[model samples]
Target: MSPFSLPSKPLHLALLGLLLFLLPFAILRERSYVTIDDNLDTEISIPYLLTRYHVALDYRPTAVVPPVMNGLPRNAMRSGLSVTVAVFALLEPLPAYLVHQALVRVLALLGMYALLRAHFLKRDNDKALAAGLALAWAVLPVYSMYGMSVLGQPWLLLAFLNLRQGRSRWTDWALIAGFPLWSFFVFVGPFVLVALAGLLLWDWQQGRGISKRVLLGMALLTILYLVVEYPLLYSLLIAKQFVPHRVEFDLGKLGPQTLAAQLKSAFLYFVTGHYHASRFFRGAAVLAVGAAFLLTPAAKRRAVLRQVLPLLVALAVVALFCGFAQQITDSLQRVIPPLRTFNLSRFHFLTPLLWFVVLVLSLRWLTSRKLQAAFIALQLLIGLGMNAEWLNNLRELAGRPLPDEPNYQAYVAPSLFADIQRYTMENAGPPALYRVACLGFPPSVAQLNSFYTLDSYQNNYPLAYKHEFRPLIAGELAKNAALRTYFDDWGNRCYLFSAELGRNFRVSARQHQQVQDWAFDAAAFQRLGGRYVLSAVQLQAPARSGLQLRGVFSARTAYWRVYLYEVVPSSSPKPGAAVGQKLPEISKFGLLVCKNG
Candidate 1:
């Protein structure tokens, strides 16, 4: 039976929804801050353009350089996802972010459904279980919060769905072609491409042809996407690729042990996220694969498994090899920086895919009672482990009281997250420009820490971190080295919201001195380890002309305030009035600029 043909199963849908709700609730209840890392930068840019300049998504944000500017790579102005949202925004002046996030969630659901229906169509019990598992995968609350901002995964899955159904139409073909364009934008493009290759090859083995029409459809989609997104993508690519490169190193020193450790870390991260969802499911899959392995005449099974598993194996090997060999990895990264773009830890998502293959084969083996029982037992054990891990992590996060030290317990000022959301909402009343000056060094807010900003969270809300803005504090920090410090120093104890009163929002000289002396020196930051890096910046200033004057921001932060200073002659700092204070009553989205400053 085709997956879509399955009768509507109300029970399965309910279970899926429940799983999603629980995941995010658990994450919110446990983790203090929303650690949305990499994509936040994109998020910030889109919203800022929408509000600051009347720049439609079709038009790049005026605050940024156009890709066409001075023969610059077009990607300098926007991102692939940005182009997608911008097009949507132009058609209707709606909040592209909320729409983007919703689209991702929906695509994730559709992808999960297609995957289950493809693999488990005949057995109602298995189908239901697989569907439930898919839902769990889609609604991982932590992933959802991250997804809340624009990212590449949604379209990635959407493209996969197109592949599964087979390109029956031109639109289907268009989307499939467009999938890889994001590969360069978000670092996950290579993995998705590999997955696409595996799927196509799997189909070919099942007696499908490599049709010209399909290839044409793919080509058409690429042209269409490029016409839309090329400007921004091109810019980003070139900027990071100039000769006499800013980052040059040898991968020769990266040894076998480093590769092994990276492999272990990747495996653990994947297991943790998919613990309950993948464990039992993966064990079942492995058994099915094993059965398929045993049943096929040795040679035939070897051929089929080789075709499917090789891609998975190759990707894993590369990730590990790069982790181990800096010279090779570095050389490759310089050529195709996608290798360096993502959190190598995120490569763990590959484990579940590998297990899925195993589970499919194992399910085929479940023809016998003994095999079934063994699979079931394995599933239960994995499920138990996942449940235990979730409980433990939650307990650890909750057990800690409000931090007495600044670094230990710095929550976002009240309504900050909400205010940003409100400001970004479509046609929400009042065009109040807000400039948030994050005081305490939260993982998501800190510029230097990799883990804190892995998925580009700050950018999602339209926050900008220029090259000059990042502290050379540590001279030259390797990406992995930076990531290690972020996790070690902050852990998951960062705050998204806090219960503290508004009056306490003032900055201290001691905090300022610490930020300047210790945090300012990137290399010296470790000595101030576990200490707060108090920094501040605002988004808007009082209008010199009208109530809604354009907003300008400087990169410099002093003491606890992000001083709203005007640029002066000769590179000398011109002091501007302090337009606003972070009073408790102020909305997170509302930056107060005193009328007569």
Candidate 2:
């Protein structure tokens, strides 16, 4: 009869498991290998730059982070009003990241548990099942930088369901209002709102009158998102600042051209889900759902099919759209101008919550407690296996750290870059006086170390800046067709591209690759205020490229052998002389020409 018995015990154990799961990350700290794709390469730097520069709340159109892209607009980063930004501002990078991860997991666990207990599994025995499912959902290795956009869907659904039934309390309204502060608008808000709108229409079609409370809740959430994301709104709608590089986004050129490739992509999405939302292997969940449906009595099968078929169809539609997104957007943009850059494929973001919802519904049908427990255990293992942090920690624990996969210390190489920064300042003056570019590694590494960089991996930046920076990498792009498509078509990572390195940005000291036939435009680089190149690999024949090897710095714990190359003073082009004239013109890609040229 005690409050801490039965379901509460499982919930408590789940919390303990969550802590144990995160313990390695906390203990290892900077030595842990976190996900790098869209994470360490891009999102991690945004918070650090915003906080370090004291520009977290700066909303001026001109506000910029000088460390990246010679002044990446402040709006390009996540909104300063977010809880994620606050955490980063209050703590150091590594601690803030770990704390955010813990916060997200805890919130996810409690939110899913509360939702299931109140709505779906109110029975005494079902509470334990609910707790187990909540644990599996919580451990999903979604990008924490996205905050609750994926994991918080349960809370949103709970609040909306309460409102629709006209039994909502103050807590439901509070959830509707408070959710925006922790979640991203672009990532999940629009899709959530659209889904809510569809539900309202569906309710009306079913002869249920529209719920005024539900509409009000939706409105409150939308208004709060607009307020929280004010800077983004200002940039896109009001500021009318320089055109963003997204304006030149050519999805047709970027997406799969063949029908077979598109279908394959859709199938992968349907089964494996997207990486951003946590690619928790869905095989077990799918099997469980199929078994539950088949086990249903023949008389009740029609009703069950009616309930689940819509979700399955919706999942298929999202997958197909995402797979063929490039071609669809290319055609749709002709009629809808915003479709050119706006990612409609984010509908896939809803799949994680949907898959779990189906699993929960399927579990409800299975009467045997042992069968349900086995399914939950299998799902927990699958979720844990997909998590890179967990996998890396296991590898570290086993004493077989992947040489190519660098831990946080080695990946960021703070000590190595600190030495580079000190040597550069001691000789070339403060980093503020000159910009640097990365050759074989991500520019984010330089940005994280407080180096002023001429390059960055930004989702949004000025189109004019992209053109101005293209000349520096034009030769490399001309040599490699794939690199050309990546930059000219997608252009998210406006980095220093090299033909020898191709598109591989994570070249570590372990790789003995050298750029032998380096074709660099030092004059163009200098014109952009670039004075040094921090390469991971040695640039053979540096003198021929108008670069003087300043120093070869190395550290025992660092993953990169910092090859410092300074632009020779005489490499600055003479007035009126063409820079990178032998290389492809920016106009060849139907892009604006650099005004300086």
Candidate 3:
């Protein structure tokens, strides 16, 4: 065959087709690393192990790094981050995350295809139009903002599609069983159940039911799936540790108005792409198409009736589930209105999906093919532009350590591994493991270098850190100094939730002085393996930290300074002893110019 000739073999052609299809995303991935969303946590997992639970991989309530849940420090069976870490380990390395994202993109695209084909595109003039709209759905760039942490989405889509088409029995069981593994997708189960019920009604109206045996099998499978995943379900719903790791949420007062508002905002989140409302244009674009759709012929509407009915069915089912869940959730948590929960954006998937259905339907109705093509092209461009920052930052990170700055950027301290190993490791004492708490640099920097840091700002950390020490930091617990002392003593042993809370020996609270955002204690500075502190703020090293300033790394062009310190415990605290060091007792703090400004 000539070089220009297309491949004749089926496998080769398939490969060629896939290559061409994925090229744009590949370039985007190359220029950018995935950031934000659940990716922020999963990225830590790329280099994680149960053994170290290194400060970088801190996202659990256990006082111990790997989360000694229920007092089992040896049991490394926590979900969420652990699942992400295993995925990273299996996939191999840094860019492999991008691969999983790409796969999710493909899965989502195919899902859009299935949804389109069985509904809107069934009677369209051009069959290829379904794929084009599906492509639009795929390239929304929301993934960049959200990251592909919810591994169960594709499974959810598969389950919905299978039930919609009345696909094989085996597939339904697999999807049903698989979804509970990712809790975010489990929420879709109730939606799926409601949809399936509607599907049975429609089928019965057409003189066919979902088949009593198959329905029974599905019901059984759902129960078994829950049974299999009950431990995780219990943890997510009941355990405060897993609920509000990163963000704060409150149960709205139980009322129709609150439900209506949440329901409305939930839909709005889909258009705006959550976070910063990055995809507002996407929402607008969908609305414009919907508006133009109003002008179409009354007679031609029959073709779209096929599309609208199923779409509405899906929407109604999802909406009802969301409304019910919202009301029930508020009712359940009403007693503790101040209690926090995860982001409610978990229910926002249906809005974009409805948008997808309508956009495709509108495209089919348009008489001007140029207008149709233009509309899709415009959306594709806007979506890409909206998400350019994700790619741009990724590229910057990949090609950084620029000498003009000769400094770290964003949440990076790539060279800290060598810096700490050289400076702090060689001189440090036994228990060989030492933690390096960070001040100036991002929390991720400490993890990147494989250091233990109690100052971890990750989504998950020991609740005791937030509950006990946080109040002290905010002066909420200062009313009773004894309580602060108790918590200070508890902070070290707070990693595990068990009856033997005070039995474990740990260092007492050391004197802490917060100058700017920096907070640490001379005693904690020593006990939690505080050999070195990498901070951007320049300070007169207090003799109390036992943290002598070993070295300061920076370049003339650099805008920041990274100070490293060495620490040692001159003497040990008494077994199971407790002490609290208030800020007043510590030396006065003065801030210096650690930045170029």
Predicted model with the maximum TM-score? 2
Write model 2 residue lDDT over 1-597, tens digit each, in one string. Answer: 211124488788888888888888877877887788889988998989999998999988667776777667677678888899999999988888889989999989988998888888888777678888888999988999899889988888889998999976888888899899998788798999988998899899999989999999999999999999888777767766556788788889877789999999899899988898778778767878777778877787777677767887888888998999888899989898777878888888899988887788777877778888999999999999888778987787677888888888888988899999999989767778778999989988888888988889888877888888899888889999999999998899998888888888988887877999777888888777778999988988988778999998889999889899999868754665433331123222211221122
Clashing pairs in 3: 33-394, 56-447, 62-495, 63-495
Q: What pairs collide in candidate 2?
A: none
Q: Write the per-residue lDDT of candidate 3 for residues 56-147, one digit (tens) a residue.
A: 23334232342211112111233433333345555533455556556655555555555555545565444455555555556555533133
Best prediction by lDDT:
2
Give all TM-scores, in the order shown.
Answer: 0.53, 0.94, 0.64
Question: Which candidate, 1 or 3, has the higher lDDT?
Answer: 3
Provide the lowest-lDDT 10-residue window in model 1: 588-597
Arrange candidates by TM-score, highest first: which order?
Answer: 2, 3, 1
- Report lDDT per candidate: 0.36, 0.83, 0.44
Span of ten consecutive residues with least summed lDDT in model 3: 588-597
Q: Which stretches of candidate 2 lie over 4 Å from their true place?
A: 1-7, 572-597
> Residue 244 of candidate 1: its Cα lDDT?
14
Better of 2 and 3 by TM-score: 2
